[model samples]
Target: MIIEGVKLMFVGMTTVLLFLSLMILLIQFVSFLTRDATARELEAIQKERELQSLKRKKKKEASADSDEDIAVIAAAIAAFEAERFART
Candidate 1:
């Protein structure tokens, strides 16, 4: 009967709507449960990046000191060469 078909359609639609709503709720619950852990992971990655940045800054400073030493060595070599020519 047409009336029975209409009733069946509505029932089916309602059932599907309820199922979809339940699925959405379950997904939201899982996301909420894992939120803290995800936040912690992000914080740890941020800390690691900060540490790497600090290490790079220290390496740059050390390299600057070495550059000064290299300059001094070059000057000493130049002076030695000049004295040797003066003596010859």
Candidate 2:
């Protein structure tokens, strides 16, 4: 009786193992079929990220340049006014 029970347990285990293996293979095959689509999606995502980063960098640089230009203009105007007052 014990031997029969052991045999039954092994059979059930083997059947489950085989089913799991088949499922894994099917999943892999599906993934392989969609590989190109997945790669394209990944590439597009990477490109979008790069573009966003570049845009952010440009905005920062433009703001910094504007600040510097404002400071330089203010200094030049102050110097001109000081010279005009001295002449008077």
Candidate 3:
């Protein structure tokens, strides 16, 4: 009975480790795909979208903007509309 329990424990541990490794690999693959953009063009596109939304939001609001809002807008514009770092 003791031998059987030991065997089962080992099997369970091995299975758990295998499952954990597979999960780690899947997470890594997903992150890589999320971060990758073809020739960095997609990053530019995404930044443009961010800037457009920020503009629309600012236009619709009449309240005074804080430094945070200006900073965010600047960041979006810098990311999207920079000619020096064009994705070629």
Q: What would the TM-scores of all predictions be?
A: 0.67, 0.68, 0.43
lDDT of every model, 2 decimals: 1.00, 1.00, 0.85
Tens-place lDDT digits, model 3, residues 24-49: 99999987886756548887889999
Where model 3 places Cα greater than 4 Å from the true spot, the runs are: 37-88
Candidate 2 similarity to native, TM-score: 0.68
Estimate candidate 2's alpha-carbon lDDT, on a 0 to 1 scale.
1.00
Candidate 1 is scored at a TM of: 0.67
For residues 1-88, what per-residue lDDT tens digits would candidate 2 score against the true structure? 9999999999999999999999999999999999999999999999999999999999999999999999999999999999999999
Q: In TM-score terms, which candidate is top? A: 2
Off by over 4 Å in 1: 1-26
User: For residues 1-88, what per-residue lDDT tens digits would candidate 1 score against the true structure?
Assistant: 9999999999999999999999999999999999999999999999999999999999999999999999999999999999999999
Model 3: pairs clashing at backbone N, Cα or C within 3 Å = none
